[model samples]
Target: MSLARIYRGGLPSSKFIDVALGQGARLLIRRSSDRGIRGLMGRQSERRWIRMGHNLIQAGKAKRGRGMHTSGETDMQGKAKRGRGWAIALSVLAAAAVLGFGGYHLWLHRDVRVYVNGVPVDIRYRSSFGEICDEAGVVPEAGDLYSIAGNLIATGGGGPFTVSLDGVELSEAQLDAVEVEGGESFTVRDGDDAVEDSEVVERITAPRLVPAERLAAVTYVSQWGANGIDRVRVGAVSGEEILEEVVQEPRDCVLASVNPVPSDGRRLVCLTFDDGPSPYTAQVLQILEEKGACATFFVLGSNVGPWSDAIQGLEAAGCEVMSHTMNHRNHYATTSDETYRETADAFAALRDCAGVYTSVIRPPYGNWNEHCWISSRGTMSASVIWNVDSRDWELPGADAIVENCTSGIENGDIILLHDGGGDRSQDIEALPRIIDILREQGFELVTLSELMDADDRIPDEAARQYAPMPEDCAWPAQIAE
Candidate 1:
């Protein structure tokens, strides 16, 4: 056969040589290649391989001229040439096998290298990009960058690695594939290309509540309610951002109702100002407002017409405005008929002058005797009498007034201070001081109704009726036992 035909299809010359030598030669070549024949060969052995190759080429030429020989001569020459050709072919085959085996062994143990953030990491196995990083102790993060390799292996986080080859961006499939070559480098750096996207999310916020002890089934919104917002950023790494805005901070709404008991279980006190709607009344209201306190104002009926705004201010300031009898009439000196007239007229004047209606009354000089009680049976809920008196009507100094009001004060005690009937400058000065002192002592200064309701003193029948003696109610002439 022609040499070109033998070498067709790019099959190695040794392959044909093995076929000519039969199966035994093929197996020998394979075994030698598997065991690494190069490790056994020296320079002299290499020189012998070169000589064998030259003889094999010459044998090919001799075979091409074989037809020119005479028949008898051809037989004799053919046997000798064939024997020599076989020897040369076997030598060449052996050298080629050893060389091929060496090349394959070198390929199996080839190193894959990459630079990780300026550090060199060497990987021995042909694993996926992610596995190679693991083997080399390299973990690329979300904000980290990767490039220079067309086929990038994913990190431990399993990603389509941001990859480029020769400055050209690669497809997602190539970026995610397991491909690494020796001496290839990639850097893990602070990259600006980390995908950053945002979404707005709304969250419902519950309104805060502050419970106030009261008899009414009502809720007062001291502050309005609103929802809250937050912004979330999504990327290689997830994070939450709390935006600073003009957010209306939630405030507590005073929820007034009958509770089982106080959370602190502390008894409350009622601060009552008698004969008010006075010149100092506004000052006292301002002090109460500043101190965040509530009190009861027992207004004189005669003063209501002249100081109608002051009386209304008392109600507006969350203070309970009640009656202190018309013209400050002494209940003890008045006859039963006169006592009824005084009590009923004062309530009528309060309702007329200031639209004020309350069930509590402070008897003139707290003198609610049988005559007064019999005359004003249904007109009042309770005769609020003070146990702790500031005696500021005597024009005591502000210090003395504060001392007298705060001392000997017990829970459930009613404190008395007049805002009118005299110069109440001391009373006004002492009001805020007394408030702070009482708060420090942990006494909640409530109105008369709140204190009585807390003590369960208001009868269920009286509680059922609205304040100011509902117009439909009839007064009994007999005294209550």
Candidate 2:
């Protein structure tokens, strides 16, 4: 039998011992204090023996009997096995710590970003690059290239693109120029990489400028130009760009005022008679008829009842019959209700006389206040006033009436005269002479309505015609009776 050898485990000062011999090369052993046994094996050999002894111990093979007596070896073997298990546990813990730290670093610095026209975009927080571009008003189209930080990210070939966090894109490149068409926007990325790799996002575009065609022909009323002559930039939107040197002017035509004559290019004059339907109205109508002219007759409501036939004859002769109030009351001193009543009565009288409703209304003495408009509730007829006063009401002589009307008859003039306030014999006598003089001077006598109507600049021949009144001459009884 061979004696069993034993070696201590771990560190210096380890012990070695020998035990009793047994049969069949097995060792029966107990602790021995032999100092020489320690020296028998070198350090490396002792380590190897400790390893083998430990493996046997764990396998439950270390025993005293038929095999080698290995009590000393068994104790040393048990210690070595325990030490190996502790080393394995420490290695596993270190590996786990490294993996946990790496995972935390990846979570802390993650972000998605976008850019436009070299400008950083932060529209929707936590949104994908494509979603940010949509919010930034970016459109995709051909020949429009987009990049971020010198990397070409997207090539616009006139196709739609879907953006996502994981989408891959081209590298970043310097943007030399960027333009958008039809109010579209393009997406820009940090570099040519997938959306996940992008560090920043932006939208790129140029500011839109108003076209010259939009402001081409802006027509404006000049405070200094001739009456009714608006300073218009013809072809501003479509025509010429340099504004035609303000050379094109509008004809002289009356618009809203007493004599609103458009001063486009031609001269115009309006002749109006107030307090009419007296014997003078017929003479005035005859003169206008002979000269192919027209005039407005502001007839008193009472006068219409007596001279309805004559007024109708004047209307048929192309004259406009407007209201001068039932009693010619001073409108400035009248109440709101009185003004409405007076106006309504005058309208009723005129309609009774002419067998048709009249739209023209003139306040007596040109006396009107803001209340007159407000009280009527936007239904009171338009009030006509005069720009040129012939002072025919003052019994101006025939020569004076002609001079007064012609003197101020510029491009647009509404001349005022009386026809029926007491004896308008002077007006009757002066009308024919005035017509003759105006015709010779190339002045066309038009009603106030006609003069104002021409301000629209449409030719009279092209103007729409209204239906003429029936010959029955039946006034609606409710209006008159």
Candidate 3:
């Protein structure tokens, strides 16, 4: 701390501090206040800052280090310089720490914390409860209990088949409905409820057509009615309408198949014969060939032995062959294993005899369940149903069958008939006449495959396979009905 040594470098106190800290060698080159380089942000305020930095550095160093005692005056000067330098260093360090702490909070600790199913997880922003659940991979399964915010959505799957969303059950929509802030915590329950208590919000009505006398070629959907589908949780429900001893809800009661089955944009009608390939199989093909038309035969597996060639000929003559099961038994009365064999055996026969496999299986009596679909998973694509029922099996005679078929034949109509069972001679007698009537009306007879693409299958309207509202469900009315 000698006066002679202090004046040795002729460097200002601030520059001396910078040198000592290795600023030129880039050691502590972070701060701008001492350098006279970052001129106080867009102005020459660095001139005043430099003067202040020199004074501060000198005093800071004096307070922290031994001063030169070469003389009384020199010792005092050295002390002042040391004190100033120490104060400047301390101030810079404190400012840096505060800035760094603030930066850390802004960058890393911004996410909202939420507990889903009792596990802590963070979401980086304000999110609704539903979005968080999805993020947490806890989507609601049908029958799983649900709650929105703090409101419980009550479903009656009860005890064994229940799921408890411990507390907050914010489905996606519900989450969107609320303002969930970041850093807030909410509890989501077990989320494994078996009976879903979802509100049946809309009613999608059956589609129908109206014949416009004035307009012969074009048609339009007459009444745009809404259908009401309720999400019901039932382990095994059996009633006249829906006799399914089942699980899971049907996507929609086949009350409405694809809005327009023949989405192919063609003027086509499907001539489908179920329980067929009978003694008069040749005659049906003859009529179809005569009219230059095609047809689909849903042949019973048992009948495949007697009428294998007719089945091949049906495919050969530009027709599609499908399944009618081994025996057309009531789907509800049969076991899952029984239904599996019924569908599998039919598929095997068609494949063995005709050298072709088809995915369409008209579940015996056009019935289905979660098990039916599960059993025939890969084998069946659709269960073909008829819009026009000939009911020729009722043996109501030729005229009645023809009347039933031709009365309401329109685009995408499936005309059901029998070619095999019983006196199919009635169907034989009615086939040519029906073909003639359809052609005279400017209809194009095509196979089920050609008439419409995809699993354009629907259940019988009489099947009435719909879930009853849960006895303990507290959902609002879907569509007044």
Q: How high is each candidate's TM-score?
A: 0.43, 0.42, 0.42
Candidate 1 has which clashing residue pairs, if any?
129-153
Query: lDDT scores for all predictions?
Result: 0.61, 0.51, 0.57
What candidate 2 gets wrong by more than 4 Å, as runs, is 1-259, 457-481
Pick out the ten consecutive residues of candidate 3 with the lowest summed lDDT.
215-224
CA displacement after TM-score superposition, residue 475 of candidate 3 (Å): 31
Compared with the true structure, what per-residue lDDT tens digits does model 2 show for residues 57-163? 44433222323445767756754664464344334533543454344444333343445664555453334434555666765344433232233444552233332
Runs of candidate 3 exceeding 4 Å displacement? 1-256, 259-261, 454-481
lDDT (C-alpha) at residue 232 in model 1:
26
| Candidate number with greatest lDDT | 1
Residue 40 shift from truth in candidate 1, angstroms: 99
Ten-residue segment with the worst summed lDDT in candidate 2? 216-225
lDDT digits (tens) for residues 1-481 of candidate 3: 3333433432345554443333222322244333322322213333333454566666655643554437778866665665554556646744654464445445443677666656776776556566777678875443423332222345533333222234544555554565445545555433345432333222322212112233211111122222234333232221112222323222221122342355555557778887877877888888888878888888898889888988889889888888889888887888767877888888888789877577566665556643455454234545556677798878998999889989967677778887777778888888888888888887778776554442234223111111122233222212121
Candidate 1, residue 413: the lDDT equals 75
* Candidate 1 residue-pair clash tally: 1
Q: Which candidate number has the best TM-score?
A: 1
Of 1 and 3, the candidate ranking higher by lDDT: 1
